[model samples]
Target: MSKKGPRLGEPASLVRMRVVPIASVMFASALPLMLPMIANSPALPPLGLLFFLCWQLLRSEMWPVWIGLPLGLWDDMFSGMPFGTAAGLWTLASIAIDYSSQRIYWRGFFHDWAIAAFLVAIIQSLAALIAHPHAPMGRVLGLIVPQIVISALLVPLFMRLTGKFDNFRLKRR
Candidate 1:
């Protein structure tokens, strides 16, 4: 017989199957803080948001609707936004994706990319508004252009990584 899964009676641990996705998401949330690079613009790419969206899209229904709450709270600890901003925005995005996924089916790579770009823009816009309530809407959105572009472009990379992590997470140990 060909070798594929765990041999004969070797069973996979539930925790073993789970650690990859959870760890990858946690690592993504913490990465920006750990990096030493400083940018001229205050905007840094939103890696935590990017990773969360990718995973949710690739594995729809894998997480509950409130998953974003704790993850966003975790992100809040590292992300320097005024508290509860990421939490609200993340939960909103999660809700939006849940509703949209029910209406759409047969997503190809480009479709996923488009959906991600739209959500990223929406998330960044709302975040900008929340963070800069007094600023003119135009300026607030303008300031976030670099952040939106960077986050949007990185969608494919995050999506690819999500798929790999997803596949590995289910592979037989």
Candidate 2:
């Protein structure tokens, strides 16, 4: 045999152990909802949800349709948006992504961004509704709109980072 250790375009024969993408996404989704020591204000935009959407949109194959259930459960535990709110929304988002992917023959970064913005806004709105069901419309809008805008603005940055992480995850050993 030749001295070449491995050939280009070859798959790894040995199974490479890597962190579960869903687990990381779920953890990221929980971070922004956590309470801080100072207790001054609500947590920053939901980084975890932003990260989740980035992962789903950028690397759809890595996540299954049912992935949302467990992840949503985890988010519910931390987000305080009622037990089933995140669960249902996240699962629905996953299904929506699946449907969109199937229907759209072509996609680009901007399209993905638009879809992400819409989804983030919707999810944030739902979370606020669940948290303050009896609150005035203006109050709810006041609560979640900023967070949605922040989340939408941060999507590109999160997508870039997730791309890097995905490259690492898929790299040949």
Candidate 3:
């Protein structure tokens, strides 16, 4: 007798369904930082960027370089930052990742984490500079250290969550 359950192939209607969750998750990750409590916190990590980078590194093929522009624009709108801040930074990051993937022949968890930390530091520093051009260097430097450290610390968790999302995306019905 034939099986009475879902067939072991791709779902016909999954095209739209798959895209929604990914974009939704990225948007959702940004929401927490917007809250007054976290927004005002001295060390609120950029969770949105964290998740985006984690997803990019985890599923390198899923996001082409051009995708960063729209995603960054989306982030800029919701983040209340300047128009091109996140857009430029995210686009740069994607291009950098693309270049690195082509240049580097070896990769591992440690390498990925180190790369993430460096990127988070650069992005956070630029974000701080863009957001507060008049602020003193010392003050901005102080705030940025904690933010970058916290964000980098969360890389493993982000990686785990991304792995779960990957499993969900690829699972057969």
Best by TM-score: 1
Per-candidate TM-score against the hidden true structure: 0.89, 0.86, 0.86
Better of 1 and 2 by TM-score: 1
Q: What does the lDDT read for residue 140 in candidate 3?
A: 90
Candidate 2 structure quality by residue, lDDT tens digits, 40-75: 334477766777888889877767898778788888
Winning model by lDDT: 1
Clashing residue pairs for model 1 = none
Model with the higher TM-score, candidate 1 or 3: 1
- lDDT, candidate 1, 29-53, per-residue tens: 8998898988755567888889899
- Write the residue-wise lDDT of candidate 3 on 1-173 in tens digits: 98777686647347643674466546754786557674453456777777778777776777778767877777787676798788899889888887887888777888788878889899889988899999999999887798788889989987888787677766655
Global lDDT of model 3 = 0.76
C-alpha RMSD of each candidate structure in angstroms:
2.7, 2.9, 2.5
Q: What lDDT does candidate 1 reach at residue 10?
A: 71
In model 3, residue pairs whose N, Cα or C atoms come closer than 3 Å (at least 3 residues apart or on different chains), thus clashing, are none
lDDT ranking from best candidate downward? 1, 2, 3
Model 2: residues with Cα > 4 Å off, grouped in runs: 1-18, 33-41
- Candidate 3 RMSD to the real structure: 2.5
